[model samples]
Target: MHVPDGFINAPVSIAAGAVAAGAIAVSLRGARRELAGGSPTAGFEDNRTAPLGGLVAAFIFAVQMLNFPVAAGTSGHLLGGALAAILVGPYTGVLCVSVVLLMQGVLFADGGLTALGVNITVMGVVTVAVAYGLFRGLLAVLPRSRRSVTVSAFLAALVSVPAAAAAFTLLYALGGTTDVPVGKVLTAMVGVHVLIGLGEAAITALTVGAVIAVRPDLVHGARGIITPLKLRVNGELVDAEAPAPDPVRSGSRRAVWATGLATTLVLAGVVSYYASANPDGLEKVAADQGIDAKADQYEHATADSPLADYGVKDVEDERLAGGLAGAIGVGATVAAGTGVLWVVRRRREDPAAPTHRSAGTAV
Candidate 1:
């Protein structure tokens, strides 16, 4: 949910900004180890995943444009930090949501650049940390099946949305520009967002289940717990001595790249046009609580850009204008995300690292 320009005061925004900066800094270093370690295919020297990470960010960006209606007026988009982390990796997932937030802030003026830190902290950090924590906890106690992984994903996403809503209420109470009681804000926000959480859980589960079924190795949440497929020569069947990971016979990193990019393009270029035309979670709460009074206008880098505000300037057709703008967003976000991940991945790749152990390319 975009907080817009006004909801939070300057002091709280600044504090959030500092916290976001520190989190992003920490995420970058963590991503280096995550991208480098625990994967057979994604080697310490592999720069291939840079493009993949970028595609994930763009995918999340496009998906966020398709808001599903939760009630009469309030809708919700995919708060993808947990889903992305489960699909990719935690550090990369954090980076992915951060990229989406950054693009929305600077390009579309959806979120405030001044409050970029706040958005990332709330949406990216909080969701990822909460989702990953719960996911790991469940995996520790449950059977290490792909189905278990998918179940955990659903539960993680379900919890993260409400947790974010609670966090927003707390932040607003600290820096609200309103005379409304904190208890009222908390009750309304949590009540409405519980419905929103169902949507989040569905998307997270479906996406994670699909990827885990195909490319379990590529799944960040499924990492370090994979049991490779083994062929029993005498028995004439493929099996595992231990608990087996879901087969990835047709799933590869290349396949994930192709599928993810295609999904992003389709959603942004075609499907986003049909998304419900209702305000999202934050917008509804703001209007209900009179939090829009101090809302300032956004100063976006793309304010003068032809494809600003998800509409192509001079395109009379609403469908056409939105379609073109959505496509542009997908393309730009993918490129920007790739560039950032490239730099991050390049710096940590040890070019001369061993090749014998990491020889296979299934991942």
Candidate 2:
């Protein structure tokens, strides 16, 4: 949920900001290991996951443009924190969601600027925390199969939304700006989001399952769960996921990149136009809770941008303007995301070289 302005009180907002800052700090270190190099994630070091994380962020952005209605009027988009965390590692996932949030807040103005910290804390940190926690817990109890991983993805995503609502409630309780009863806000946010969570679970599971099915090697979270590489022993085929080769040669990576880029464009340019025209989870919560009483319209507000408000700035034809806006948005997000990801991947690759040192990393 993109928390708008004026919902949480100053103290609570500041507190949430501090919490988000700390989480981001922790995630930066985690991202370096996940991307750059080190133990616990040697296979998933910085270079590999960084560019991948940026792509995930951009994908989340494009997917969010295509909101689907859940309840009668309320709707939701991919929250992405859970999905990203499960697909990537949690530390990198946090960075992924943060990137998406930052883009939305600054460029798209989808989320409030003042409430930036809250949005990241609730949507990014909380969802990742909850989803990853649930996924790990389930993994421990369930079989260590690809199927189990998919199942975990489904359940983790389903639960993350409501858990996020609970976190929002606690934050509001700490720093609510209005007179609305905490119970009402909690009930409404959770109730509407439950339906949204179902959509999230489906999307998350399907995406994770598909990636695991194809390039399971690309999925940071599924590193150990790969089926042993099939091999010949006598006359029978040994069942095992293939071991990662020392120097990974490009295998269908071009195809994967092309597919991702194509998918992002289609979603942003075409499918987004048909997405449900309804207020999403946070918007609804704010209206219902009187938390949006002071949501000042965004500055740098795309009011003049040709694609301002997802419509061409001056194009007279609604269809044409919207189409162009969508196209532009797709291009921008893809380029931005690809650039960020490329940097991360390059950094990850450097650490693998014998002459590299992991010093001088700025948090």
Query: Which candidate number has the best lDDT?
Result: 1
lDDT of 2 by residue, 109-147 (tens): 566667789989999999999999999899888877899
Give the TM-score (vs. native) of candidate 1: 0.87
Over 289-321, each residue of candidate 1 has an lDDT whose tens digit, in order, gives 877767744445456767667888899999989
Residue 177 in model 1: lDDT: 69
Off by over 4 Å in 2: 36-47, 229-251, 296-306, 341-363
Which pairs of residues clash in candidate 1, taking residues 3 or more apart in a chain or in different chains? none
Q: Against the hidden reference, what TM-scores do the models get? A: 0.87, 0.85
